[model samples]
Target: MEGSNEELNPNAMTAEQTAALFSKLRRRRVSVAEVEADIEAGAPTNDAGRLNLLTYTAWMLKEAGRGE
Candidate 1:
């Protein structure tokens, strides 16, 4: 849900900023499936898609947070 805002300029963000951003997202208590469903589609298993898949899932997990 957090990433539903403006498109991210991954190039413009530092690792710390990204992590902190995700951390904030986690506190929002969104669901992994919610984030997944918001996206047009899931990532493929191809090598090129692996990182993207990981990033998407990580984002979802972040938004979902702990103790869920």
Candidate 2:
């Protein structure tokens, strides 16, 4: 049987949750190279721009974690 949405996603974060996380990362000022790596690894095909943004956000999160 297919899992319910909650079961499929234990964290149950919404798009708003994703956006908030991205926003925090943006405030950290991550580097472009790191963002490119994340884009290569995480985003779906033909979604270069979205992936780029998400990757950049992820990089920012990492940088923020390091206090950069």
| RMSD, candidate 1, Å | 10.9
lDDT tens digits by residue: candidate 1, 9-43: 54343233344455675686444444334352542
RMSD of 2: 10.4
Per-model TM against the reference:
0.26, 0.28
Model 1 is weakest, by summed lDDT over 10 consecutive residues, at 43-52
lDDT against the true structure, per candidate, is 0.45, 0.43
Model 2 / residue 7 / CA error / Å:
39
What is the alpha-carbon lDDT for the whole of candidate 1? 0.45
Q: Model 1: runs farther than 4 Å from truth? A: 1-11, 28-68
Per-residue CA lDDT of candidate 2, range 33-60, in tens?
A: 5444545655332332443334444555
